[model samples]
Target: MSADTQHSSQFALLRQRRFAPFFWTQFLGAGNDNLFKFAFTVLVTYQLQVSWLPGEMAGLVIGALFILPFLLFSATSGQLADKHDKATLIRGLKLLEVAVMVLAAWGFHAQQVPLLLACIFLMGLQSAVFGPVKYAYLPQHLNERELTGGNGMVEMGTFVAILLGNVAGGLLIAIPEVGARWVAWSCIGLALLGWLASLKVPASPSTDPALVINWNPVSETWRNLKLASESKSVFRSILGISWMWFVGAVFLSQFPAFAKDVLHGDEQVASLLLVVFSVGIATGSLLCETLSRRHVEIGLVPVGAIGMSVFAVDLYFASRGLGGGAAYTLAGFVERAAHWRVMIDLALLAFSAGIYSVPMYALIQLRSPASHRARIIAANNILNALFMIASAVLGGALLQLGLTIPQVFLAVGLLNVVVGFYIFLLVPEYLLRFVALIASRCIYRFKVRGDEHIPVQGAAILVANHVSFVDAILLMAASPRPIVFIMDHRIFRIPVLGWLFKLAKAIPIASQKDDPATYERAFAEAERVLRDGDLLCIFPEGAITRDGTLQEFKGGIMKILEQQPVPVVPVALQNLWGSFFSRIEQGTAMVRPFRRGLFSRVGLVAGAAVAPENVSPAGLRERVEQLLAA
Candidate 1:
């Protein structure tokens, strides 16, 4: 694509009505969050006297104000999101922000630091409730192809907001004569504007209107948590998101002290560090779309985690050069901007965080059950709250125990290495490409063609000849984007293979007799996927070929085609007649040995896409068969 065409395509996404409002709402929310928190932190850290409350105590108080809401209100917020129109819910939340900002203004005017803390906590509560609606609503609004781009945009916006907020908060604090009060009022105005913007958001139907509302925070939170935990992928995603927050919270919380004690810089320099970090996050988020080539791209998570660790460790060394002395004023810090290493560390830390988070969010949205998505999101919020709190406490405790802020950075960075290794080891499916490449090198070699026929950037339906059970895995390896395979529900439940499929987010379909509802739901999900611009691969023969011959095509493929006019790519898999995962012995307990050595040809042929107008199920089947024959 030419530069202008590419620019138009990118800009086209922003023009979308379904996406724009939610994008703005989230952007404004993230921006306001940082604005208030950074402002509050600056107040307590620089403006308030130590005699009123120790600096450490003030920081702890600020931390508590931010996290306490998740513990108190996340469950209720999730339940509410499921029981109402999400657009209305979001509007209501934005209005709540207006009220909270009023209190903030009062706190600023009266110089009541404690009251401002209360308002900060209230904002957190609002955000905790907003979290479920924010995530759950995406699948409803965006097509699958749009999801990645949409997510990338939202992440990019959020980081930009954080950067803006951090800059504004610091600048406002330095203003004279009711400057802090004016900042609070400006925040309130922004909140109102956000509310007005949210009102323009189209209605989002409730996924589960009949979901029982639970008022008991403890029990309800635990129930939602348990429900999400039941799905291993969802549970793991929660852990991954939590780990991100833990890592981020540690870095963000210590930045001020690191600037003051280690870099001997003033509040402006501290805020500059935040700006650099946010810039990194924005860069990384935008990079995710390009890196994944527009898929969920779980593979990037490990890569991101590694970058975070390396940069954070380097930051420790970078901080060691600062001589112990009294803190410099804002002007003094600017003169010391020659330290390029500090800039590098800040940028890398932020960039890696963006890379780590964006994919995980996409995975959760793609994998979670549509009906219970809000609850799952609520569960994620709970875990994030818990993790961030733990991060603050642990980092603070370590600092108290004589670990310098720089050392803490190094420690977290090193620990991230261990954590990343463990998660990948635990879930190798996320690292399937690496394994597939190694397998290709040692065992059966494979060839992929007509890949250009597959939509480079939109949803498609792939019809392939299923030669063996490993066909989906092979297809996934060959295709540029992730494929949501339509599999026999039975195979979807296979011990080891089942785990892998679920991780890959395959949609399982059952025979009518076995479970009619599940079968219908699978088709519905397939339709949803196509509508969202995702690729759904199905074996028209309905099951693996028993005698290495194509079975009669099923009507399910027709049903999918009828629902969406997206391109249908025909694929042919060959030469896997005898492999360990293939069924060489029908109805027998025996299996073939693992194939080894290169030059064992495995051909994956992709034919030109069959237009929806010119093709029926039979036509698609015939085309695929011909491709396979060639």
Candidate 2:
């Protein structure tokens, strides 16, 4: 097969039985939701008038009703996911959606406000319960390498559905000729299609069959949240995801008003705004999958958050001095090229959101235990709902305090900066990932071959031929798992490099001739780390080579093998020697200045892992030589 076809095959899951059905099922459900919500909203705003609940308050009321189910039912929903078959439960939810749409159809035809509100609440309940199941199902099916791409696809599908659903809703309801009849039937048809699709999704067996179902909403919600907080990284990740939701809720709420009051455009303009945002996000999500080399790189979250703030602030300024009055038609809105900057800002904001969100979902799946993974996902849903509601309340409070719409956008942007920095600080792994990601993107076009050799989940010792100072960094960049390197103790004392070494969790060893205790300590730590099912990388050569050549493999690797009989993966670093970090002396300097320019291409070859019985210092070195030859 061609390389193009081979690369694109990473998304083979989307075409497979395991993933495709679930994808379409959720896609149709999301689209149907927006169809019903917007159809009824337009019905109230344009055709009907009630004293108790004014048309102006429809958006808030609908938003509240939808979010309420997530807050109330998610705790119980988590228990259901962990204790029963996910496919069956998901199918049941789709059937419930069909029933809800039946009610929605009647409400739309009869123009009954109470029945319509009930349908909204029921739709929210379906979404709330499915949230945990939707996210938790990915990790159970896909391999670790496929998780990032799978998530990117799912995220892209969801936003595309949203964009299409809103457009369909607007077209069906707002057009006087077609009106409510078309929208009502469309929603019902969509729901039924979702149910049919759900039937094809493969069964996902429960992890905790004996888990007692938690029935109390209030206390069970707290218990589920506490379970999520058990791991610091997991908890912080939940916070990060929730914060992004809050930011998104704020922006999604403002688009209609922003289009009419700020951009002076009608329904078409609002749809256009959503279109740009959704397309940008979809593009960004796929871009993240490509950039990370299909790894769950948490560093992109920080990148996304920073980009969100920058674009949002720019959006506020772009709207400055632009006068708002009579609504602009679609043709007129597109005529002025200057108005495009505002669209650009909106697109970039959503683009950043795509980057920020995909990795976070993958992280939650990767880190959370399979036994309670669904419950953890449930906790995330609850937090997202609360944060979204808080976003609404906060925006209201700020606007009441005399802030303009553009000013509110500015405030949300600033808050993103503060929230992002706090989360990064809370988890330094994300910060290290930031450094690793930037280094790979800017300093070098780091490439890895034979990454499939790295085991997805197991204890493995990586035996690598280290060519330069940044060998570990380059290897870590290519690896899907966090690798702990065993390095010389003196390297851990090199000022800033030492600080970074500790952050990367490198194991520092000393020569027995110099410090026997440190040398023994390194072996003990290696044993412990491997026992915990983590990857450990060691340079088989005792020292960095003075020339661009391989050295004899040392005996220390045998010592690690003796302590723990984990598999050994031989790795080779290609094109890194003679670089600045390598011990290639130039003139009077040990390391030359700018010998190799920025973004230099380098290769890392991960050879297949050898069983512990076949591993030897010389055998591993020969394996490294064979990989280098390839």
Candidate 3:
């Protein structure tokens, strides 16, 4: 591809007119939400110091207020998103933000507690209504390949906004010259800015304009949840996502208190903690785009979960030595013993959170059915609200039961490990992708070539030279599709490794001369897999190389193609001959124990597919040899 025609960067979308406006519009909106909320929190906790609700319980109440609208209105909002043009919805939402800010400004001027709480709930409502419109608009604008990058940018923006807004709210309210007025007016102006940005966002057509609106929150929410639950994987992913919210809510809601009671730090120090955490999240989120090669890689989900759990556990240890009533400023907090460890723990925890979240959102976008996608997102929002609320209730319960903040952190971290293990066990593909991601990125140095020759969609026969036992896993790591490999039945009995292949659903092919029934049954299974529109990979060599030389292609390729008539793609693996799986010593390949040093260079080359009618045994061998040579 020419430089002019190729995409420059995943972030290059931000420079384009199609995506830039909406990005800024939403960015400003998220910033405004946090700014207003925190400014109010500062007013209540620091200045007013209300006695009616103790400081410890105040965060729970405010957080519950903020997310309440999500539980109540997510379903109706989803219907609106589907029933109206997204750009129009964005414009309307921005206008609503303006009106809400006016109310917020009025409440701030009067120092009315009821009105401020109402404003917080209004902000939550704004966020809830925008949820479906926020995500569903992406697929409408970008191609499938762009979705991961686009979501990454969105996550980066949200976390950055959260950081900036919290910083602004935390700082501005403390300044006597600025106080609530400056905060309120700044929010008003930001809302107007968001509205202007929304005006420039191009129209994104609704997915289901003809659908009737469901006003009943109870039944509609249930219906949306049911829609999301129809797909088992997506549903489990939704649960995973909600659990993320739960973990997040507990951690974030405690920072203000944690900074005071545990770290002996002031409000500025708490704000700095949030700032550090948000920065970590933004960094990890952007890194996910690069790490996954801009795909919805479920593997990163487990990796992220692992990091989050480990760091969260460490956070408890880091914060254990807080001597209460010391009164440390931000700089003093840093000067204290082991305090730097706390910041590192918070940063890594949020960083892993960013890595964990982006891929899951992309997975949802790719997995969801288009017609009901908005409702699915709405269901996700509802569940998110529920989980967050539960976090508050459950966390308050834990605190009441005499658990310290560190103990709570320890418990949550351990719980994360359990949940992550459970999810990965239920879906091994995530674990496989994690393995593949590690292999490609860190283990063997792989250089893939001629990947463009492989068709992006539809059934095809992938005939590769099986130079190493690791060939199938390596190819799967490289290819976007899930490939079902045809392996020798004996190899499938190799204890642990064999069990993994069986779990991967690799077809066990036997040599017809030795076992006719098994051979015939394998062919029948291959046909069934292809007919189901899945990718099928076969080693036409019928065995790995005894020596590092190209073997003559067996006739199985022709036989399968005759039965299935799928396009045949020829692939070659080079420079893997001396690997432990290869027959480097020639005798007893499995027992010989031979391998290239770590980080050995390896290459995989693919050739254009040959039509089923055009492919012959000799021609296919020539193609494979040509690829290997190239």
Candidate 4:
């Protein structure tokens, strides 16, 4: 089949039943999270008269209950996911959700606030355990090409769920007849529905069946966290994801107060702020697939962070003009729509969050080893939980120390700038891209075709002919998204290029004898990248051609294909041979005088995609040769 047709066919598979059920299950999980929390917040703020615990303290308690599970159970969940059938594990978790809901019902009926909070904590436990399985299950069901779109849909669904759930929770609790009980019952129903959906998921074979389960939460958590930190890109991605949670936790925790004191809105209006935020996240999540053009583009992370800071600072000013104690009904909110600045802040915040999170999720997935992919994800959850908890404490402390909610928003927003700058500085790959992008426009003219062969957004494997040492950099520069290159371990150690590749999060592999473990790790990392919907680029020939001609494809690509049949976009780098970095005249140094005006024409020819069925080492080599010849 033609590459275009092949690419389209692979994407269609993602919409099928085997994948959709699991997607919905995760979607509902996120939705239920917000739904229950919103309901609890309403209960604390309006129904319960707690003179002992201040409002901010109550908010902190709710936040803690939700995050505590990640700290306690995420490590164990990762082991469970690696050792068991993911489908069965997910179904079991769903059943546990039912019991948790029953406990929630008891809390609502008894008017026992602490019991309700305990139930929330239990719910967080269930979610924390489910986190690893949610991520690990994807590579089992999806092809590489579909990973990005699949992840994008899940993220989008999650935010949509958050929006709907928050809205429902608020509306349900405000009802006069059965406020708290009604919300509890609704949560229960949703949990059951999530279980039903999970039942439809196909069985997923364990990658590590003999893995010993670690029972001790603290030590196991530390071990998993260390595993995540071992890889540079994986480590940075975790930090990026954790920072997002930190920023989000701060903003979300303060929204109720912001709406009440600043916007002068009641419970309904406060909920609307959440709704706007969730809507923005949903919008951004959906747009990720398009904006990234289906590749893992970390550049978008910076873009998202910038928006987050800008809008957050603007929100403080926006609140200044909102006046005080001006409550509005649902209908009144529409009538007095002059408070649209709040809407802008909410939308931008969510949108930036979407941009920031999609790539980080993709990056972690791409950079982690498959054998321990879920564990790494669990580690990420652990850190996310920790950061979120800290955000709550920090935000609360600031407020108690006499900072207004709007001022807290400004502080967090400003802090985001500092944090973002620090991360970029530490990992200059993002900065290099900005430099490369500017350089590409000025140095050499280039064009990309058949970019559609790449997924509109999600995981894909880019197979390019390696004509020069800078093949990966050139591809990274040409493509709109970030490309995770699989490199010779030796190339990864090159002085300047090595550091650049490290910063770019390139995966380095070696032959079995040199390092069998590293070789296995390379493929495992590639699998994770595919699972996260990030781009994985490998020189199928395994090394750059000495004579600027495509070589035979290597079986490593085949091994990756076996694990995940992601769409493979064949890229040919044309006319880059005579450049300064190119291997001109058997690699004799061309370093000094020729470097200044040594600009050369470069062309990135993106041929149609090749499906897994159509790809073999021989066939892929021949196909790449043809593209290069063109």
| Model 4 TM-score relative to the real fold | 0.76
Worst window of 10 by summed lDDT in candidate 4: 1-10
Q: Which 10-residue window of candidate 1 scores lowest in summed lDDT?
A: 1-10
Q: Evaluate candidate 3 by giving its C-alpha RMSD to the native, one decimal.
A: 2.3
Model 3 score (lDDT) = 0.85
lDDT of 3 at 203: 90
Every model's TM-score = 0.75, 0.93, 0.94, 0.76
Candidate achieving the largest TM-score: 3
Q: Give the per-residue Cα lDDT of candidate 3 at 425.
A: 78
By lDDT, is 2 or 4 better? 2
Measured with C-alpha atoms, the lDDT of residue 511 in candidate 4 is 89
Better by TM-score, candidate 3 or 1: 3
- What are the Cα lDDT values of the candidates? 0.79, 0.85, 0.85, 0.79
Runs in model 4 lying further than 4 Å from the true structure: 1-14, 336-338, 433-474, 478-603, 606-629
Give residue 249's lDDT in candidate 2 (0 to 100). Answer: 78
CA deviation > 4 Å runs, candidate 2? 1-11, 41-58, 586-593
Error in Å for residue 205 of model 1: 1.3
- lDDT, candidate 2, at 339: 86
lDDT of 4 by residue, 27-61 (tens): 78777878888888877776677877566566677
